[model samples]
Target: MSASKMKILISGAGIAGPCLAYWLARTHLNAAVTVMERSPTPRVTGQSIDIRGPAIEIMKRMNLEEAVRSRNTTEEGTIILNASGKPFAHFEGGDKGGDTFTAEYEILRADLVGLFLDATESLSNVKYLYGDSIKSLDQTEKTVKVTFAGGSSDTFDLVVAADGGISKTRDMILDEHITKNCYNFLGQYIAFFSIPSRPTDPKMWQWYNRPNGLCVMLRPHRNPATVGAYLCITTPARGQQDPAVEAALDEGVEAQKRILHEYLGNLGWETKRVLEGMDSAEDFYMSRAAQVKLPKWTNGRALVLGDAAHATFGVGTTLAIESAYILAGELSKIQSSEDIPRALERFEEVYRPLYTKSEGLPPFFPQFTFPQTSWVLWIRDSLLWFISKTKLYKLLPADEGSGLELPSYGWVDIHRKDE
Candidate 1:
């Protein structure tokens, strides 16, 4: 495919597709790009996420750093409590890496997608079709023809899947030969929703952990209008993917609330008020905290990015931002159709290790605990509290930017006006 005439079709407009569209256009490609989403409009809301390290640097290149920073979920830090809401542990926020990093520059998922869509709207070669998905793909050496659910078909020089963890495209290409590695299960199911803020919890973020579940709260970033909750319910490994996954997934939003009510719901720290406010939320999200790993990210012209390639539960948004960043960076170096395979290979080679290196760390230390014996749990909790309060963590090297020796690549910037 000639650079001047290359046409590309991308799946999943959520984060990676639109983000890749923005960067591909910035490369001055004499080609055309289109993003097809399964939803009618771009996504409007989702759980909070962060952009850190080289991913943050990529945003700076795209000139979106300021806007992203402006939308951050300024959660000062997390407050851990007992059933009665007494303070047990506190983490002063910074780039201390791991869970605290999830709180860094956190923006609601839908907002991040909107930012990418808005940024690429003006590019002449870029187009987005919502409420549809690719139904079939027929690729020859020269071009690939994509059939959509809406009954339209199009041809392109290449197709990429950034649709996320449960990727249909990845499933098709691998043909069930490659099973996604479920690295470590957090033994938790998380659910969250946006609700009107109450007078009682003003500064944001309160969490409580018990044997079978955990509850967390946060005030929206500079938005006095709402608050958010992150609830995790523990389940046994054999119970992770039940036949009732769909029904259970739908129950996520209320499951946490219902569980909270059953557990700490009576403790009276504004629980009723928060649940009342949540009633008005349009949607509630729920899911198991399981990571997705694959033997490889590519099978011929098909390749996966973001969660589809390496879905890390409890990883928050930073990992997604980094995955998109690395995928796009490697792809930008491709010089021709023949160069594409190498690009995808290098992308996997570059990112998978970085992700592997971060495994086994706590999601929100002092605020969360794995399945430990009662004796071990008490000691670990105490140590976490002492370290958090005494600032002993400052002695350890922050887990920021400790990964790959990445190469520099030009990226596109998209910041809001005030930014």
Candidate 2:
């Protein structure tokens, strides 16, 4: 089969799937690209996310940099506050391409996904399917046959899983042992929701750390009337999972709320208002922080992309965009369906080193940040205050961009001319 006529099926339309679809349609104009999302409709609710490093360049190549910047969350900077709501430390926002706690390209996840979807909407060969997911996948030497949850089956020349870390589609094809051992959970649980903005709320991100490893954060949103709230708790040991937290995760949102309240409800700095907002917040989401490191990203004609392949915490969005671009660029060089596997292998070879280097957290991460006692909290606060006052944060290394050289696949440039 001609590469341009190849049929590709991509699972999970969140970030990576739609992005890959857009680039595939552009690179091979006649290729049939289908993106399937499990949600019944487009999810427009998510916490703010940062786009740093190569992702900013990817946005420019796609002619989406200005559009993305127009939707910035408008977070001025970050402020570490004491229990009394007094600021103890402050960090200013960095430039658009600089790496900082609050990135210059900070925007909500839903907004970025919307931009990707919009970019692909005009391509006749790209299609989107909502409210369904893959039930199973069977891969042959030439193609992958996929069975859907809605009692339907289809065959495609290539199948890519761009689903998130806890990917069910990845489980259908990868070995059980690989699936079990790939996730490195960082003994932390976090919840994000939107609350009505108050007159007292500052434009900067307000972070309060309490005893017993509890932390609360309130950040500004693009919409001035609403603020984003985050609640995080750290367990005693790294990689340890709490039974109650696990049970709550399996249960519904109310159970999750109860667990969060049990841990952070009494902690003073704006806890009451945040919990009250949580009760009525429709977009509350909680998850365990984890990084996925797979031994191999491809098996036969099937492959996993983005978080399903390598899910780092802070740089996940950037990595997803960069990998999608590289995968599409490599596939564009192929002449026939027989070349798909080689293209997939080349992608892993070129990108795996970067992903491996980006897969770790800073030294003494969650434990050091979340103190369990008042003395520790004071010590941490004092250290932060000293750092901020001394302007030592400026000396820290900035995550400018991935050192990898991007390949030019000679694909058509679909960048908007009017921009």
lDDT of 1 by residue, 1-419 (tens): 34457787889888778877777776634457888888888777678776655566566666786888787776666666664667788775546534462445677787788888888877777888889887888867666788888998888777888887767777755546675453434456666777877666646467655443335455454576777866555544423543344454566655545554554455355556655666566756666665677777776666776776667654635566676667667777776766666777787788878767643344443223632244544666687789778867556554344253556776444332243
Question: What are the models' TM-scores?
Answer: 0.84, 0.95
- For this target, which candidate reaches the highest TM-score against the unseen true structure? 2
For model 2, how does the per-residue alpha-carbon lDDT over 1-419 read when each residue is reduced to its tens digit?
A: 46247899999888899899878866754678889999999888788888877777777878888998899998978899998988989887756313558877889999999999999866777888999999999888888999999999999999999989988888776778767789888888889999999988988988899887789999998889999999998886669888998999999799999998888878897999999999999899999988898888888788899898888888889889988988998888887899999989999888787677677788767877888789988999999899888877767556555454576777775533243
Q: Best by lDDT, which number?
A: 2
Poorly placed runs, candidate 2 (over 4 Å): 1-4, 96-98, 397-404, 413-419
lDDT of each: 0.65, 0.85
